[model samples]
Target: PTFGEWVKYGLPFVPVMALVVGLYFYFAFRRRIQVKSLNISTLVRQASRKIGPMTRKEYITAAVLILLIVLWVTCSDRFGMGGPVILCIVLLNIFRILRWQDISKIQWEVVALYASACAMGKGLEATGAALYLADRFVAILPDFMHSGTGLAMATSLFTGIATNFMSDGATVSAIGPITVPMAIISQTSPLMVGLATAFASSFAHMFIIGTPNNAIAYTMAKDPLTGEQLVTLGDFFKHGFCILILSFLVMWLWVFLGYWRWMGFINGSVA
Candidate 1:
């Protein structure tokens, strides 16, 4: 599902997210009081002066990206996101906008990592490992099995914790089949469980290598200009743990508020 669907399904979390962000900024500002803050106008002026206008190639690249986004949003059902992406790349190659050398230079290792993770997830499902795990998990959580809120919270917590150690894709792939069926068995909405599990998978900030985005951010911390490691492992764990906790609380609140009920995602008690 797209981000819009996530928003629609997760509307109850909106207020929780807002509160979390507000508190984050409030704390951040308090911590920054000791540092010399740059004037916003001066910073903007300096940034504007340093940056040049986009070139023709840059504009073309931006347009292509926008087009791809539009296709992914509008034509996903008909063509799928991958089809449009592949088509865009093929067109770019055919038009000489991107060279084979440029493609070769792309980080294939990251791509391979994701592909392998997905394959492993599929393998786990195909081998009944996911089912075995899910059955055991459900059996242990007999109390939560009869309640939609409990199930959602449990799934979110499980996926969130798992994603900290494994890639998000792999975590979801392994847990999704299990949680979805568990939700059904409990008479809860499978859609809610699935979405909750998927969203929780994105909370993989505790470990730098847990997700590709985290890995990319960690790599970027090693500045090419200064060769400085801007972000440390301690920095990730310190903040990531808090964020994970807050995320779990927000998810719990969202489900407890019956917002999913308002969205027609769940009705009555799963019990």
Candidate 2:
């Protein structure tokens, strides 16, 4: 889905998300989480240490980053999602924003891990496991739940659950094609279902293998970016598990409340 559509689609739910954040802070404080285990380190890098007016290099870097985001959002279909990343890297080096030493500092192991995980996800797609899983899911769901609205919720929740085991992008790539047709078969708006599935893909909170960000976070404990422990695997799972449940509820209600239909993302009735 386009960024504009996603922004408009979920804008109404921001208050609910804010309240959830408030509750999180309230509970965390009540539990003394901030006192007991909140480990924060000085994030000062070389550029940040030079507390002065914006430098020309800094402006250039910031501009490049903004352009990178725009390209990623607007040109993803034409260039594929990974294209912007590669282009951004090259541009950064060309402009001296990042040099060979900076590149050398990167943990190649993490890159390898992501590449392998993506390969595995691609294999699942090639083998048609996505379709097989969908068929099995529909077969097991009750007859009544096969309707448009019910199927939307079911597909979303299923997508959310599935995403925790694979990268979010891969999950979307694998399931988007299937859910669109399934939505049509169920007399639902294919666009709505497709959007729901895409959003659900971001619910990959339970496993490091599910997303590159998760994997990188998992490595903070041992990656030497920090001299001490930053996060343990168990800690990641515990916090992420809570976030995952929250996301599932919010997503379900977002659709259940007719937000998609109201926003014109769903054609015809949301029924």
Candidate 3:
């Protein structure tokens, strides 16, 4: 979504998720359970050592990053995804913020993997395999699940499960076919189901290779002191599953309370 569209439909989403996640952290901190084991004060001290004050180069880098974010959010409709990134690269190079050596040090394989995942999502959409599978999947839903609440639950369940098998982008692409028919079946707005599917697709909780974010993080992250893998499959399934459940609950709560309609994501009454 572009800037205006995002303000209209996405503004409500942020606070809801923030509230839920914030409360979770707050209570978890209060319990002091499942929240702490390692002392990160050393790492925090290490990171803050040289970052005491923003130097000229740091100021320039910060400005460039802010500009890049602005261009990304505001001009994405005109420039698409690659333009802002490429422009940011050029700006960074011109400012001596990023050098050719730094660029070359990047793991090209990771970029290739991300690009391939995007291509796979597009290919699935173009070849109609996603549509076919989506159709068959919906056909199997019980008659009782052909209503608004049931369909929302089904969409969340299917999306959460599917995202664990592929990237979030691919899950959304694969869900495109399901949304329209789901709207018809459930007598809700197509936008409602589509947005729900898009939001739900981020619950890629079971596998490190599930989404590009998971893969990139899994590959690049390390335990600061031990140099051990920071995120394992077990961690993904354990903590991530709780996050997925919480997210689903939040989404369901909004749907049940007609918050989606309040946010203009749905029009007319949900039949």
Best by TM-score: 1
Question: Where in model 1 is the C-alpha error above 4 Å?
Answer: 2-4, 10-19, 145-147, 212-231, 255-259, 267-271
Give model 1's TM-score versus the native structure: 0.81
lDDT for each residue of candidate 1 in 145-203, tens digit (9 for 90 to 100): 44577788888888999999988877786778778777766777777788889889988
| Distance from true location, Cα of 251 in model 1, Å | 2.1
lDDT comparing candidate 2 with the true structure: 0.72
Task: For candidate 3, give the lDDT of residue 211.
Answer: 74
Q: What is the C-alpha lDDT of each candidate?
A: 0.77, 0.72, 0.71
> Candidate 3's residue-wise lDDT over 1-271, tens digit each?
5645545555666788778877876775576556466679988988899679678888888898898888877898899767988998898999898999999999998777656766765666678775666567667889655656566667877888888887787667656565656666556666556666777787786688787777788787897898998668787777677777887887777653457666554342333
Candidate 2: residue 84 Cα off by (Å): 6.7
**Pairing residues by index, what is the TM-score of model 3?**
0.70
- Model 3 poorest ten-residue lDDT run: 262-271
- Per-candidate clashes come to 0, 0, 0
Scored by lDDT, the top model is 1
